[model samples]
Target: MAAIHMRMLGYLVTLAMHGGNMLVMNSLLQGPVMEDPNIRTFSAMYKRFFTVWTMFLQLFVASLGLTTDYYTLKYRNKKEPQWLGVMRSVKNRIFAAVLWPTVFLVSSLFWSLYHYDRSLIYPLFADKILSSTANHILHTAVIPLVVWEVIFQPRSVPKKHGVNVTMLTVYMFAYLFLMYYTYIEQGIWMYPIFGLAYNKHICFPLIISAIGVMLFIYYHMQWFLTRIVWGSQVKIKK
Candidate 1:
């Protein structure tokens, strides 16, 4: 738990700085960019890196894990073994077991995609808003840190895959709603793939369906990564 907490704290600082850099570029450097009538919704608060919402979600879950582990450790009474036994409960595994996949997968995919063709996934204009350091922080460095956590941390995955998938699906649904709302209000889409020109009829559903499939696949893949990195050091029980 200490290792996880430390990793989360480091990530918190890295991601926060990355975000701050993006905001400064968007507001101060590219002043007229936000004032454009077509995309003027919440111009002052617009984050240049907002299109990639998964990064934000990863930051959120990392913060949540740090907070949970901090208070649990702070409040732990080692004098009583009975109180310590509760650490293995399902509730305690939610952060590592359920949400870790999102961070690892997003980190892997974004870095790979950026390397393969920055222009295809992220256009030339995006370079003005995001720097190499910020890109590496969110996309490259995160992969190893999270993978290390998975390898080292002993976690109990949810007993029911259906439950985990359902929760993620609901989250994706809400995220999509926010994505569309932002587009309607400000005329800018966070992700290029979410652009209405992609296919108004099927793109949204396709994105959600793809996420559902990815979650299903990674739900098992995480345990495999854990097993390989840890060998017999740790075991995950459903």
Candidate 2:
């Protein structure tokens, strides 16, 4: 647990050291990658709007999660069960019912916008580190942290574990396959980090490490909720 937290902290520090830019400049560098529709030109369209939308939307969800957590716990009776046993309909209905659809819609929006016709409006990051780092900071680290807050809130622990585990697993695999398609189509990589070896071999480790970190956090969060906030409850037979 300590190691996992340390690793996350290390990532934050490294990102800060990079002057905190998360956006990589999207130079139309001549190579095999120019073929990608996402980066083919700087035309203005829904693509740009979608990028902004995704970043802000992620931020909003994260904020909402934190605010929700604060208010719920503020009024909640710590002595009483926040949730019933697995058999309870309300908890499952309230949490599970909208979770999948909401996630799928949001993720789909990103995938679609990423590939939309006028997609290549701006370079992900500008050439200068100090200049583009702020964008990168906002785009990568900040946005994910927001999503993390939403996924790891104490009252939402069970739903958070189930949803994040399922969604993140699916997303990682789907992105793996999509990356191959991207490489084939553009002859380049999706993330700059993957372009390290002129291929993605070095990048796989980063993805794996991120997943491990997420799982560790998930477990710790679940523990905090179960043992402290939610407490144990009796299962009612259906």
Candidate 3:
């Protein structure tokens, strides 16, 4: 079971990284393919490129989470499973399923709020490519998914593992740098907080706020993982 969860998570992280990288490259090359009335530019090249790449990425990620869920149920009471007691109920499973995307949304919102005046993160995601209403709904729904994954997903359950706040901090730095590259290359903004750099002195504060959000989310997620994965256990009496 540990092996299975590990493989699934490895695949999920791989898809996210690969998809993000490809999307960044696409953005850099394409520079925001806005559907303008004057320009009929929904070419075969564009469709095919996104189609195959996105399909594989989405498939692997979805499969990882679903497969993890399946394994959890199959070996719920089996000893020697690394993910034992992680999902004690249907609610726990559901939350685990939704966690990643929910984290993305909440983290984005927190960053946006802290850097409210900056507007660097605001401009990129402002335009609704899929229509404003649908986009808004999509954004709102993603938060729950992210939260669930954090709260319930089974991990290796390492007790007494050294909590390195430094590593978490470094990850946020790398994520932001890559995010900027993603925005520049893909010509689309993943977070609105990247939209505000209107030649103002707001960059430093916004970046700081974004980092804070990342830290908060990271520690919170770590705590959640510790609580459900390592801290809690159900013992069977003979």
Candidate 4:
């Protein structure tokens, strides 16, 4: 009972956190930042951002967590249904395969570039649009929240972990394609770093390779953390 209660509470917290983030983002769209012609133009391409993509993923996983919990609690005294089992499996897979890795990657890359030289990734002008609170919610808070989910949530390591990694690879490459497409269309790089790259031929591939390596490391780190928290064989409650 206590375990179930804790899981449900965690789901609720995750939902509220991401829901609040969505609200913050929505306000930014309607806020004074849109008044700036540059910001207004950039906002049109906001969906192309990895941060926005990850935020949507987080929101989705949180919703799945809550729905799974609701059914789990409702059927506590009875045998679990097949649909509930499927829901649990889907939620677990998404959390491990997509949500965890992306959040880790975005947070690490954003902060690394932000600190190294904010102008490279996020410029001074961006601060006007992304307030400190929104910025932290988008980049900083996500890391701990994902870590918390890993520690608290029981997830089985997928039998075919390669599939998960492949999915991530596809996503990264798709985004890379989008970056080039945007540049070709708009005559500008999606990120300022691309503009400063002396050799696009060399730098772009290196960038993608570095991201691939990071995702690989994060996947293994998640696998290790799951083993530590839930033992070698994680027993998912159906």
The TM-scores of all predictions, comma-separated, are 0.66, 0.37, 0.44, 0.89
| Tens-place lDDT digits, model 2, residues 41-94 | 322222223233334444343334334434445545754344423223332332
lDDT of 3: 0.45
lDDT of 1 at 89: 43
Candidate 4 accuracy as TM-score: 0.89
Off by over 4 Å in 1: 1-52, 67-98, 108-120, 200-204, 229-238
lDDT tens digits, residue span 15-123, model 1: 5755675575456445655555434433433443333455565556555555555556766674434433454343335544455566655665566657786543566
Find the 10 residues in a row with the least total lDDT in model 3.
37-46
- Candidate 3: residue 169 Cα off by (Å): 4.2
Task: Compare candidates 3 and 4 on lDDT and give the better one.
Answer: 4
Supply the global lDDT for candidate 2.
0.40
Candidate 4 local distance difference test against the native: 0.80
Best by TM-score: 4
Of candidates 3 and 2, the better by lDDT: 3
- State the lDDT of candidate 4 residue by residue for 1-238, as single tens digits: 4655676677677678767866776677767778887787677888888888898888788788879888888999999999999998888878777788889998999999989998888977677677788798889888877777777786656568787887777777888889889888987777888777725678866777788889888877897887788775466443
Write the candidate numbers in order of decreasing TM-score.
4, 1, 3, 2
Best of the two (1, 3) by lDDT: 1
